[model samples]
Target chain A: MQNLRIPGPTPCPEEVLKAMGQQMINHRGPEMAAIMKEVAEKLKYFFQTKNDVLVLTGSGTGGLEAAAVNFLSPGDTVLSVSIGVFGERFAKIASIFGAKIIALNFEQGKAADPALVKKALTEHPEIKAVLVTHNETSTGITNDLKPLASVIKGAGKLLLVDAISSLSSINLPVDEWGCDVVVSGSQKGWMVPPGLAFISVSPEAWKANAESKMPRFYWDLAKHKASIEKGQTPWTPCVSVIVALHTALIMMEKEGMQNIFKRHQKIADFTRKGVKELGLTLLAEEKYASNTVTAIVATEGLDVKKLLKIMREEYNTVLAGGQGPLEGKIFRIGHLGWVTENDIKVTLDNLKLALPKAGFRS
Target chain B: MQNLRIPGPTPCPEEVLKAMGQQMINHRGPEMAAIMKEVAEKLKYFFQTKNDVLVLTGSGTGGLEAAAVNFLSPGDTVLSVSIGVFGERFAKIASIFGAKIIALNFEQGKAADPALVKKALTEHPEIKAVLVTHNETSTGITNDLKPLASVIKGAGKLLLVDAISSLSSINLPVDEWGCDVVVSGSQKGWMVPPGLAFISVSPEAWKANAESKMPRFYWDLAKHKASIEKGQTPWTPCVSVIVALHTALIMMEKEGMQNIFKRHQKIADFTRKGVKELGLTLLAEEKYASNTVTAIVATEGLDVKKLLKIMREEYNTVLAGGQGPLEGKIFRIGHLGWVTENDIKVTLDNLKLALPKAGFRS
Candidate 1:
């Protein structure tokens, strides 16, 4: 079987896969209530926070919307710091909900600059909130979130984070970073399939939810909190995904989140160095590179499409293409979740042979 | 193992369960695109509409939100016809999003009266839309949607239907009924697990979409339409569920939609007869009875909780407890999706033996 090297829908272990096949259960029964409670607690533990971690039955984008719609009101000024497409998406979600967005974006292949963010917040004193992406999957850069959080927290504005690709793969302690709202998805380092989105809300975030006037229903966290207290969701949950996530969490705890994060860092470092050995420069600079995915700049005269085609067709290794403005300029290889060193060995070995056919000569 | 009969999250067949555990694939890659295109077409066929059908990575409740948010603007007058709790929830969702709702509820255990709906629409000429539930799981009543749709359509008002528990288990042709938007989920008659919601939007719905002013991002159907044209969801979908859904659709088509509807009807009829033979009176009247779930009144002096407990603990058969006002007054038995005669026989056989223990002296 080919190694599916995408950022979010990473390969799940056999045990995790088997859990998905479990029979459907009563989402409103005692079994689901127990599972829900345990899943929420384990997620909070994994997030390294005591905040109220909520499991949502949508994608990471939905969780991002949940973060924005619950906290920001119409005409409420917010500073949105962007490093790549996902960062831009967080701003777009807020803007769609009527927030006045002061978008401060960085170039591709770079991380968000906290100095610029501080300056923006200083100038836009009307801003009540700040949105930042912890890791930009498209750019393969993990922003230094703590400094940005400190800036927003120091200003007394709420700090909301899109940790969709970072949390479990790296060291993003939600409570320690002072993030008022942090959103993540199950298809990342959770080693589970896509479907469930998770978010943790701080007291400050709940305060914002009380008066925020952006129209919402399904994404409303207040209803979620109330229903969860009764051991139920506001709606029928995606039970099978929860079943899979419940099992995946057990695996994560067994491996230990610390070791899982370190394994990701080690594999990512190896991928970057191995790609460099094949004469492909990395997209994100070494200092700020993400440990979950490695973005590599395709060499001049080498067709990115051709490179991907050869890699998939002959080498049977799939990778992610650049998104938005970064399209055709770089390609990404994911190395998170249950990704193995042996898988990387196969990927790098394939790259060594496949690069020549794409007109790479060095 | 228990035979779970909880309206939704019904027991899936072995083949369907096996598909849920399949390996993950790149959600944005070509393989996923092909699967998405096929899924949409089959959903359109199953919905029996030439209109656009969209698949979302959320639950049935999320799909209901999608219907309200996409068609109604804030302050728009809407006539919400309620039969049970889910009906009330649709109105609640619309109300939450700022719609001025004129909730016209029928007596419990009865379907929406077409005459009353007509009168409400006539009196409230400013009502821009009408909301109705196709199947009320709590009361086990499926409204006669055709006449209601005719009245709303004749008035040139938009018609939105929450068919979450009804669509595939029975017949409600989208175009024939002139429904602007109809929402269903995978956990019910689709014979799959939860986590996937399907929605169909009519051309008339698109007309309403242009003027609707509900603030939406994650559940926005416009972005979904744009993205799906290229065979991708605006956000990452529940990949494994989609894989399961794809397999389930194949099985569904093989059985044929008409036959599947007949199967649900037959099982539901058998369940009602079996319950009646045990001296139980159905909550819903015979004419408006739901062909998915059958709600039976709890015997006088019988504790519904004790009945449910005995059936579950001793007999290993899980039945749905009455919801909302029906609590302690009724119990519901589901016969949708992959249910067979033997499954229902086991449940009814267990119920016959267990009811007397809960103080049903007869």
Candidate 2:
């Protein structure tokens, strides 16, 4: 199989994959009750939160929308911090749901500045909510959420986070950070396939849900929470994926979350050093580089797409090219979720050989 | 494993289950593009619509919300026809999105009346849309969609269908019936696990997309359809379920749509006959009884929950208890997707033995 290296749909382990193939069981039965309770508990542990972490049968984007719609009403002012594509998406979904957005834009490859976020919030004191991306996958940047969360929470505003690509791969102590609503997906560092997404909602967020008036049904967190209390979901879930997630969570628990974070950090460091060996510049600055994925600025005179194509076709290693404005300017190497040291080495080896063919000279 | 006879999450075959366990892949890569395109084509075949059927990473409820939000704007006048719980959900979601609902209520256990629907539309001349469920799983009544479709079409109003439990098991030709938006899910006759939902949007619906004023983001059909044209979803999909769906669809094709429909019909007939032989009354009127799920009135003096518990604990069979107002009054037997003569016989055999134990003498 090719080394399928994408920021979100990372490789799942064989055991977890096998678990997904298990037959579908009664979703509203006794077994499901046990599974759901265990899953919610483990998810809380992974998120480092005493709050409820609810699972929804949708993608990460769906989870983001849940956080947005559940806590903020239509026309509620939101100070949105954007660093890249996924970061900007938080603001976009909120805006579509009628939240008045005060977008505090940052450079593509740079992390969000806490000072700038503070300035924006201060200027727009009416902004009831603060939206930030903990990990910007498009740019491979992980924001320093601790300080940002302090600013938002200290101001007594609701702090919502998009942790889709960061949660399990990095150290994100959600409750310690005072994040009111934290959203995540299964595909990034969960060692599972894409489908199910989760969001941790605090008591303050539930209060917001009581007052929020934006039009919603499927992404309604209130419905999901009530059903969870009853050991059911508001709707039929993707049972197979949830079971797979249960399996993946078991393995993750055995590995220990701290050790998982440390492994990712080490692999990310190795990948960055290897990319620098090829004379390629990192898109994200050193301190803020994401452990789940490493973004490299394409070498001068190199077609990023061609570089990826060459690696995929010749070396059976698939890498993601840049999205949006960064297209053809950067390529991302995912080293999360069941990735080994050898996997990173294989990707770098392919890049070293393919860069020369893409007309790069070093 | 018990015979899981839920209306939607029916038992899946072994091959489809095995396919779900397959390894993950690069969703943005060429292989996914091919798989997505093929799935879309096959979905169109199953939906019997030349129109684009968008696949979403959510449940059947999400698909229903998509139909409501994508077509009718907030405060638009909608004539919502309801027979039971699932039917009322259509109106409920639309109402949540701020649609002005003109609820035309029907008796439970009976199909929607075409003449009544026509009269309601005629009486409410300003009705811009009509909402109906093709199969009301709550009461196990399958509405005759052809006449209802004719009435809605003749009135030149958008006809949104919640075909969650009906589409593949029973035939309701989408294009021929002029269903502006027809929605379904993965857990039904597709013989796959829940996690994804499908919606076929007609050209008229796309025109509605231009004028829709309801707040929406994740349930946006336009975004889903635009991405599907490029062989992708707007968000990360349930990859494992999609692959399993691909496998299930292959088996379905080998059996052929006509034969699949016949099998469901025969199973429904056998299940209903078995219930009758046991001196149980069917909840749905004979003419409109659903071929996918059979709702039977609980035997006299029997506790529905106790009956279900007895079936599950003692007989190793799980049957759905009544929902909504039918709770404690009726129970349902599901026979859709991969069900055979043996499966039906087993469920009936268990029911026959368990009824007396639950205080019903039959």
Candidate 3:
């Protein structure tokens, strides 16, 4: 069997996969309502917020669009604190919906500076909301959201977070951070398939939604809120994935949040240490390194493509290559969701042999 | 096991369900590219169009939103032909996106009138598009799309179709009917789970897309078309559902379109005749009755909820309640997507007994 590892489409546990094969149920019936109620209640525990978390039947990008159009109107001034590709995507979505974005960009593999964000908000007093990514999967960097949230919320700006790749694996504490809206996907730390996106809406975000003028229907949070109150989704949801998510959540609850975090922390540490022992440079600084995925700088004269190929074909292991400008310059190892130290050990052992084969010698 | 007989979230074959449990593959890798190419080619056979059919990762309603937001600009005049709840929902989505709508509605449980649609287009000379549903699952009626398409296409108006429930089971030759845009769901006749929506876009629709001014990003078909050309979705799709769909499509191709249509026709006939023999009345007229779902009017003096309860609790058969105004007045029995004559017979047999227990002697 292949050790399938990517950032978001992480491998699911056998039980979670089996749960996805359960027969379809009536989405509007009492049974479905019961599932909805259970999933909704359990979701709050991960979000760490008392806000109503509504489930949408699309990918994480769809959830980001919902975060944008539901709270910010055309010509609304917004500050986007982008650290990597996903952070930039959040801003791009807002811009596409006509939000006048003031982009505050950090380096490719660095976290957003809260001081710069504060300065941007101070300079642009007209900014209505601040968009940030809790984890930048593209560069394997997690932002320091507590300080950033304090800066944005202190300015009374609505804080929208793209927690797609970070939520369940990392501790976000949405309520404590005063995030107005937080978006996440199921395929990441939930150990579920990629069909559902969860969004938590605070009261301030709902106030923004009422006056927001961007045209929307499918991603409208108000409709979801009204429907979810009665234990239903406004649209027909991805039923099987939701069922699988229920199983994953129950397992997660059993394991407890602190254990889940410690597990990811340990695996991420092992991966980083293994790469360093191989004499490779890490992409992100250790302070901002993400606990879900690890990125390593491609060694000089090493064909990253060949290394990845050898890993996939010869080792039965799959890893992610850098995206966009970082392509061929770095490779990513995903250690999130259902991953263990043994999986990381096998990958590192195979990589040790494959590196030299790909012209990397130390 | 519960018999899920809703119009959507239809029951899948065991193999298809097993396919959904396959381990995750890299969505951007060569393996996923192969699945995308195969599923894309097979989907054209179902859509019956040379147009590029893009698979989205949301429910059918999201597909409808894509069809409208991609082709129609805000302030654009559009004629919406409504026969049921879903038809009205199409218009509602358009209106929500700021399209000026001229509604031409038919009676409940009836199909759209081609003459009225033509008249409406004539009256509204500025009408840029005509939105209609091929099969109204809410009322169990299938509109005569050929005539409606002829009217709209003859007038040089863009023809957008919601074929969510009738695409594979009932014939909808998109290209032959000159359909500009067609939307469908996987949960219906595709015999897959409820996470994917497929849309076929014609060249003329692409032309309209260039000028569509409604602000959109996630549901933008242009982005989908660009990414699908590279054998990738613009977003992380519901990967498991796509895997399931590949299996479902292969089975469909083996059965052949003619055989699939005939199978649905036989079961629908059996269901209608059985319902009538049980001294019940079908909601839809014979000429426009859908071949997927059969709607029966709740007999007077009998509690429709009680009948549904008896069917569910005693026979383990779950039926669909009516939507909007039809709620409590009609119950729907879905016969699409892996359903058999035996399944319908069992539902009918149970209904015969359920009616008397719910206080209906006849």
Candidate 4:
């Protein structure tokens, strides 16, 4: 199989996948609880926080939903910053939970301005929380979350960050940045399959959880916290994925967090340089480009769909298309988890071969 | 590993486990969507309905939360029939969602009385829905869903059934029996590892969803339905689990639904007979015994905890223990999913060894 070039469910280490193949165990048993406790502790270490991290047996979107349901009440005003598909999804999810969302929209390939977020928070004193995406995967724009969190914190509001693709690939000190609630998934920089999602809760976020009146049960934070204190989960978790996460976290620990972040930056630099040398236009602002994935505007009049299809069918390389308004306008190449300069080279070579056949003269 | 004798995360077939180790795919891409469509279609076939089957990336409890959040609103009255741990959990989840609960409590190790449920609905006409557990794994008692559904349907009240352990092992003709909603898990009768949970909704349930004021986003029925109509999911799913589920459903189709049900019945019958020959007291009433697993009460002063530990540590055979008030009072033996007659023989032999160690003289 050609290497996966998508943002996530990126190529996982063979050892990580093998860890998931272990024999199943009863979820309510003590052994399972031990595994859960270790995962929770390791997650806190990865997030670089002393706060509690709760694991949800779902995707990163599920983690986002948990934050919404556990922190905001019906009719509560929330300021949402949207620059790409995932940013828009946060607004959509907030609306579904009956929250009155005030969305600040930006161009598809741009990042939301933290100044605009501050303006909205000041104007709407009723806004209880401000939602921002640390890394907008659709546009490959990595917003400055430290500044955004400062804006929200200065306004005396809770800050929720979607750090799904940015957690380990980029520098996100959850506590240092003052992010109230941060959501992430296992598949991205963790080098595992797409199953488990997690969120680290600050004391401020937990306080909001206490007064939140949203209807929730399985994703309820109170039950989760109570169970976590006992070294277990309120529900039966995805055991196989949890096992896989344990192995992945150990690898991360061995590499050291700072080194892992630097490695991702190096690979991202290598990929962006290669794409530029190939005469492709980067989608996001150069100063704000994401370190996990790179979005390239389709230049030289290339058929984005045809290029993606040929690469997948012939070379076995899978790339992601631009979601929402960016569809047919840009394509994304991922540089997260188990990805290296060599993998990026392979992807670029395939793109070079497929572009000519897709009507690109470059 | 000595066989998985527990109710869930039961011994999965090697092929099913290996399927989970398949290379991960980008969840937002068409490849993952195609896998999701196949899994959903197979689930629809297994559910015996043309209604939409939505999969969530969580455990069985996550599906239960989806049902409660999507169907009932805050201050809405729900009648919950509680006979065992799962039944009580249903009530707990509903209450957590701010639903006013009227519980119909039955004795432990017994099934809920259909008459009681009817009377409760008769008195409280404002009750928006009724939650019932088809098979309470905690007590090994399978309630009569048909009779209960008949009563609720006659009264035109919405019926939500937790058919987690009973879906593939027993007969639950969702449409014919007038079940408005049903929730299940992949780890149980689906013969796969824990990761995915599914729920089937009827027209009446859809109507309730339209008027429901519960705060939900990820578990929203409308969102799931809209995406399923396009043969996709709203967020990233457990792709490998979906592959395993597709393979498992194909195996189920070949076995035929009726034959699979009968097989469970035969195994359950043989187990009950063996327990009776050993002169052990059964926890569940014979008239309402579940076909999935059997709960054996500690007779002749047996140390249930010691017996369980010995079985696990020495023989590597995992047996479930009584939950809630019955903890340490009984041990459960599951015959659900991929269990053969020889498994039963091995379990019985281990029990014979454990009984004497537990200070049981016979």
A9-120: candidate 4 lDDT, tens digit per residue: 7887889878877778877777878888998999998898999899888889989888888999889999989888999898888888789999898887787788888888
Off by over 4 Å in 4: B28-30
Residues B63-150 of candidate 4: C-alpha lDDT, one tens digit per residue: 8888898888889999998898899898888898789999898999889888988899999999888999999999999998899999
User: DockQ, per-model, please?
Assistant: 0.87, 0.85, 0.87, 0.73
- Arranged by lDDT with the best first, the candidates are 3, 1, 2, 4
If both were scored by TM-score, which would come out higher, candidate 2 or candidate 4? Answer: 2
DockQ, prediction 4: 0.73
How far in Å is the alpha carbon of A22 misplaced in model 3? 0.5
lDDT score at residue A360, model 2, on the 0-100 scale: 80
Off by over 4 Å in 3: none
Best by lDDT: 3
lDDT of 1 by residue, A75-144 (tens): 9999889998998899998998899999998989888888899899889899999999998999999998
Q: Candidate 1 on B1-362: residue-level lDDT in tens?
A: 77898798988888888989988888888888999999889999999999999999899999999999999999999999999999999999999899999999999999888888989988999999999999998899999999999988999999999999999889999998899899999999888999989999998899889888998888999988988888899999998888888889999999999999999888988998998898888999899999999999886677899998898889988998899888999999998998898899999899889988999866
Clashing pairs in 4: none
Q: Give residue B127's lDDT in candidate 2 (0 to 100).
A: 98
Fnat, model 4, is 0.82
Candidate 3 lDDT at B2 equals: 86
